[model samples]
Every structure is written in C-alpha cells, then in structure tokens.
Target: MEIRLFQLLVPGVALLFIAAVAVRYLKGKINLSEFLLSLIFWMGLGVFAIFPDNISVFVAKLFGIKDNVNAVLFLSIGVIVYLLFKLYAEIKENRRKLTLLTRKIALKDAEELDEL
Candidate 1:
C-alpha cells in the first residue's frame, strides 16, 4: 500500500476542522441540521481524500466520463451549484419575512399615532 502525503494531510486537517465545528454546534453556535449536514460532508470528504481513486473510478464508470478526474470535477461542480441555489432560496425567504414584519410594525405605529 502506498502512503501518500496528500491522503494523510487532507484527512487530518479536515477531521480537525470538523471536530471544531462539532464543538461549536454542541455549544449552540450552529443549528442541528447545519451541523449534521456539515459533519456528513466533511466525513465524506475525508473518506474520498484517503481513497479518491475508488470514488473517482466509480463515478466515471457510472457517468461514462472518459477520465476519473473529470468525474470528480463534474460531481463537485454539481454539488456547488445545488448549494448555491439552496442558499438563494433561504435568503429570499428571509427577505420576505423581514418585509412582512416591517410592514406590520409600520401599521401599528401609524395606528398609535392616530390614537394620540
């Protein structure tokens, strides 16, 4: 078995970072869903970093990609795009809620002023 520096280095750093995030989640700095999703993502990253060939080859075969690296690249881009859309939706919802709350407050203030 070949011991590659990258395989060790990447996993080691990722594990440490994941641990820190887990602690923050426990302390209530982050939500449960976010923590769980991040944990799963980091663990998968560690596994793939250690055995990239396995995942790349599997993906390439499944997707009919000519190269394993291309398979990995394509999958990564897809994940990023999905995450971006999710974030956009969350931001839009938050903006809508904020607008509703501001309107309610303004109406209340106007009513109070009329009473005065």
Candidate 2:
C-alpha cells in the first residue's frame, strides 16, 4: 500500500466539505455564494474520490461496517442526495411563486390596498 501526498488533502476532509455544501443546498440557501461553494466543494470531492481513501472509509462507517461497505453507503448517500436536490427544487419553485403572488398583491404599497 502506497500513501501519496494528495491523499492527505482529499478523503475525509473533501467529503466533509461536500456534505457542508449539500447541507446548505438542502436548506434552500442557494445564493451566489452557496452555488460557488457547492461547485468548489463537489469538484474537489469528485477529484478526491478518484484516489479512494478516508472518504470510502468514512462512508463505510455509516453502515456499522468495517470493509467493502462502499456499495451500501454509496447507494444510501445517493438517495439522500437525490432527495436533497428534490427538496431544494421544490422550495425554490415555491419561493418563486410566492414572490410573484406577493408582487401582485402589492403588500408593500398600503395605498394600493385601500383601493380594493
């Protein structure tokens, strides 16, 4: 087994970085800052996954497993990831509609309401 310098930078740290972005995404916090962070997090994590080290190990631990657990962990993580995106999309769509409806009502313009 050969340990490389790049391995140290990736693995657990990188995946944790990805999880933070994903968490922010799931929370409907998709601003420019969030998007940029998510992009960087995923890109770095993706690049890191290529090496295979602590990330796989950390994921494996989720299943109360010791080895060869990447398959299960990966699937579970994928489902959660899919659900997170779906949630984000639904929330974003709702916010868009709310903004449009609120604009129509002119809640901020008290004079407009007086005419109704």
Candidate 3:
C-alpha cells in the first residue's frame, strides 16, 4: 500500500505527460478537446497516484466496493474505454475526410483529362 517510489515517480511522469500534451496543443498538432482530455487524464492520474489511500477509500466506499484496488481498477477501465471511444471517433472522422478528399481529387483529374 505504501509505494514510496510511486509517490514521487507517478507525479513526475504525469507532469511530463501534461507538458507533452501542452506542447503538442500549442504547436497546433492537437485540438482543444484532445488537449483538455489529456490534461484532465494526467492531472487525475497524478492526484490519484499521489494520494491513493485518501481518494481510493472514498471511491471504493461510494461504489460499495470492498477493496480500494478494485475501485481503482474499475475507474481505470472506464477511462480506458472512454479514451478508446474517442480515438475511434477521431479515426473514423479522418477516414471520412480522406475519402471525400480522394474523390474530389480524382474528379478534378478526370475533368482535366476530359478537357485535354
């Protein structure tokens, strides 16, 4: 229960991840939603990792879970599912846009050929 190393390590890693996300967002590589999601995730992770006992016990009790570890696991699974869904949506949108762009380019090329 007393993970001393993680007490320091987790927050450090979380901060690094947050910084990376911020940098990407500022560079215009990622959108606002993506930035916010990543920021919230890392901040939550850092908070939970830093104060596992305090928060975990409350969450476990709230869910009627006997074990704090189980509560943490449940929340982690939920977060993973949410992120996966978001990723799927982004991929689907990108695919749709790419298909539309390809069709447009092909039509333009065909029109040019017909003119020639």
TM-score of 2: 0.37
- Best TM-score among the predictions, by candidate number: 3
Residues 29-79, candidate 1: write the lDDT tens digits: 999998988888888889999999988999999999999999999999998
Instruction: Return the TM-score for candidate 3, rounded to 2 decimals.
Output: 0.84
* TM-score-best of 1 and 3: 3
lDDT of 1 at 76: 98
User: Would you estimate the TM-scores of all the predictions?
Assistant: 0.79, 0.37, 0.84
In order, the Cα lDDT scores of the candidates are: 0.92, 0.69, 0.92
Q: State the RMSD for candidate 1.
A: 2.4
| Per-residue lDDT over 1-116 for candidate 3, one digit per residue giving the tens place of the 0 to 100 score | 66798889999999999999999999999999989988998999899888989898999999999999999899889988998998899899999999999999999999989953
Worst 10 residues of 2 by lDDT: 46-55
Model 3: per-residue Cα lDDT at residue 68: 94
Error of 1 at 31 (Å): 4.0
